[model samples]
Target: MTGRDHDHVTRVMRTVSCDASAARSRLAASWQRSFAHHRLDPAAAPPQDRDTTRLAEQEEMLGRLLHVASPRLDELFSTIGQSGHGVFMTDARGLILRARQRAADEADFIRSGLVAGGDWSEEAQGTNGIGTCLAEKRPLIIHRDQHYLARNIAMSCIDAPVFDHEGTLIAALDVSSPRAESDGFNQLIGAMVSGIASKIEIDLFRDIHSDRQIVLVGDDRAGTALLAVDRDGLVVGATRSARIGCGLARQGALRPVPLRDVLGETSEGLSGAEKAALTRALARANGNVSAAARALGIGRATLYRRMKRLGISGAD
Candidate 1:
């Protein structure tokens, strides 16, 4: 994290905390509706359209984050598996760029072409993660009945907003499934996606503050994280494992700390050369499989298969 990232975190924290406060007040005075049978009808409703001004704002922000993307998104999608859940990447304005789903669900969204050019607005598609997250600019988990559609009541969702160098929202990474209860894997996946967005923001910040020192703290309860820093000692980016391993607090800024000191005993736990090789692969390829495969002397598809065996996602 550079000074800019720190500032962004601080601002976002304040904004969110305030939003929570406001929501609490509103909730106290209003009826707390149960999600058990909640539904929203798109028909007999007011006309709704995407706000072009807002779309433009979000597009500019997204461009910054995408500029530093590792290009290994497809690999990450495969490592996590596209079954039993729906993973999607969207621009800030709620247009779907890419989506992954379970085989059965994939077929459903595929037909609608919602996996590609779909517009996922609460008004257009009814209340959903991709739309609601962009609308509210908040991290949220909408489970089962929380959906605005009666038909969608069987599904659950979790989403987080991605920001850029200027603290502007650029995109959202979200996951949806038919699970009744949120589980450990959901927590792990949500955390991983959030870290990726954070890394992109940090990377953008580094270019602006090339002389400042920053650190990124990550929570590593389940996966590996790839941390990157510039010559200025600022944390430019990190993989899922790094964030979780470090147990980074939400909205917290990481300061420069020696990797050895941060993962002293844990380092011993990860001594296998193969693990090291995979980690190297992720870094060398900027998290891209094709690049990593070329460098590692393996086929692209083989690299994906190997990553599965290694319990790693993306290039790692």
Candidate 2:
């Protein structure tokens, strides 16, 4: 299979789970009661707007998603197999489309009713990273004690919104973890969640974008990119810096460019060698930083520092 094919296959393999039925049932029940059960301090909150009002009545949205979801709800199920992480997806309406956690860590989150079908707006769930990010359409990493609610203070969640072909928000992907783990781990997992959202966006646009040219804009400093690709990586959507690094264009939209070509040459701005070393170490360690550091003959703290310096993140 091709690389893109490989990527999808690997994702499917990594995300398959056996307990999806139980998880779905739990999520549905949670969605039914999230609003009624939640008690927010009105004096400490901000004013609500039109979108917030619409999100308040999400029972129908939840029912639609649960009804249409069948056999294999790939998007919904992906969150469950996140390797000890917690994830939930919400639509533009802020209704929970799905919620899941690694089987090993589901109990604590389940107890808090942070499951599927729940409303997760700042107004409903307080100042949670997921709720706030969705409300504001920004990326966030809310650590322990950062959450507005006392019960949520011990939890950490990193969330990003997913947009469809028209840039309409289709869902929000979030990874929730306990605060005791390294902050680095949370960042990494958040990045992974963003990657998944990006893929979903691509999928949404794949049909209409096949003929349109794309320009790829890479932010070397952030280790991220604004990719505009056709069937193949045709660098059609790119920032000036990305075009300069990849030798594309400066003015109008350019032709399609392959990812291989665009990523073939590492610009002087990016420390490619160091990034490769870090990725290799992490792979060898099976995503365990402490083990990877030992294998690489470095201290765990040193490895974390280097990863942060390199902008490398974990799965959370």
Against the reference, the lDDT scores of all candidates come to 0.56, 0.57
Residue 92, candidate 2: C-alpha displacement in angstroms: 1.8
The weakest ten consecutive residues by lDDT in model 1 span 28-37
Q: Candidate 1, TM-score vs. the true structure?
A: 0.47
Candidate 2 lDDT by residue in tens digits, 1-316: 4454445334323222233532564322222233234444322333222344444455354444333332223553474355555667677645565666666777876655556645567657666767777666767777765455445556777888765544455567777766366777777767776766665555444433566554444545543334566533345565433545666664355666555567775443447656767787788678999888888899989889889998998532
Q: Give one digit per residue, the lDDT tens place, for model 1 in 13-88.
A: 3433453443664221111121111223312132334455654555565564555553434545665654566667
The Cα error of candidate 2 at residue 120, in Å, is 1.2
Q: Which stretches of candidate 1 lie over 4 Å from their true place?
A: 1-64, 70-72, 101-105, 111-113, 178-185, 204-316
Instruction: Mark the regions of model 2 whose C-alpha exceeds 4 Å error after superposition.
Output: 1-39, 42-83, 208-316
Q: lDDT at 104 for candidate 2?
A: 71
Error of 1 at 90 (Å): 1.1
